[model samples]
Structures are given as C-alpha cells and as structure tokens.
Target: MEITRSRDFTAERAWGAKDIANMNGITTRLHWTDQPYRWHVNDGEEVFVVLDGQVEMRYRSPEGERSQLLEVGDIFFASVGTEHIACPIGEARVLVVEKEGSV
Candidate 1:
C-alpha cells in the first residue's frame, strides 16, 4: 500500500483547470473570471464542489445544451464521457474530485 501525505503535493494547471494528484485520484481547482470553458467527452466522471463563488455548467447534446447554476457550497457531478462546459457567474473557484482514468 502507499500513502501520499498532504505536504507532498503541489498544484499544476492545464486547459482551465489546476490539478493535483496521488495514486488513487486527481483533484482540480478551477477558476473563472468572465470566460467560459469547454470540455469534450472523456473516460472518467468528475465531481465538483463550488468553493468560493458561482458558476454555470452547460451540458451539450444533439438538440441543444442544458445548464445548471452552482453557488458557493453547491455540489454537482458530471457523468463519465460527457461533453460539457462551465463559466463563472461571478468570479468563482471550484474543487473537482475525480478518479484516475482517461477523463
């Protein structure tokens, strides 16, 4: 077995998300100003915690896009292999927790 102590990790960024990881999972911090971000389908699911502000999550489909607004302390999950996007309703920060997989 392996244990990763809290002090051993650092943050990294890419494609609008800041991330950290251990053997079991990936954690991300996403920040938004006024710009929206778009995401494509991938293999894993993502769970999000709204940490400091508000955001709008948009899920794309064949007919149209559906959206949900998340405020501070709100939690939501994205299904595995779905296309989606998000934007700040206000200056926002989100904590994303996900398993180790392609998504």
Candidate 2:
C-alpha cells in the first residue's frame, strides 16, 4: 500500500502535482501551489479539496462571475463545462480528482 502526508508535500513550481492514484479514466492528485490557475472549463467533472491553507475559487456562470473562499477541509465541485479558477491565499496543498489528462 502507499501512503502520503499531504502537509509534508511541496513542489518547485506553482500547481506542481504528485500523482496519487488512477482508476479507469480518472486521476487523483496532490497539488502544491502558491499562484493562481487559469480559468478554464474541464471536459468532465472535477472534485477539488483543500488540504491546507486557503484558496479563493472563482467561477463564471449564467448569472455572472462569482467567487468563494475555500478553507482547509473544504471541497469544491465543478461540473462539466463549468468555468473556474483557483487562487491560493498563500502556500496551499490541494487534492484534485478528475478525468485523466485533464488540465
């Protein structure tokens, strides 16, 4: 079996990730970031979990643009074609689950 301590993980670049698992066409990853990710819509659904620090999640919907603050232990779900971005408050670790090869 494999084990990981999310708090101890780090990366040299923003949004750097360590692969955790892959099943079927899905991937689970641990990501470390200190910068913001670009706004884009995933081809499939996405599950985002904040493992450490804080993140401001921004998204655009039919109404307009909106944002939410995600703290440790918080989760954010994005359905297919949902435009969104994640901006770290400082240094943060995030767990991401999505389709394999998705950005």
Model number with the top lDDT: 2
Q: What would the C-alpha RMSD of candidate 2 be, to one decimal place? A: 0.5
RMSD of each: 5.5, 0.5
Q: After superposition, how far is residue 72 of candidate 2 from its true place, in Å?
A: 0.6
Shift in Å, residue 82, candidate 1: 1.8
Top candidate (TM-score): 2
* lDDT per residue as tens, model 2, 1-103: 8999999999999999999999998999999999999999999999999999999999999999999999999999999999999999999999999999997
Clash pairs for candidate 2: none
Please provide TM-scores, in order, for all candidate models, with all chains considered together. Answer: 0.64, 0.98
Query: Residue 46 CA error for candidate 1 (Å)?
Result: 0.5
lDDT of 2: 0.98
Alpha-carbon shift of residue 56 in model 1 (angstroms): 0.7
For candidate 2, what is the TM-score?
0.98
> 51 in model 1: Cα distance from truth in Å?
0.6
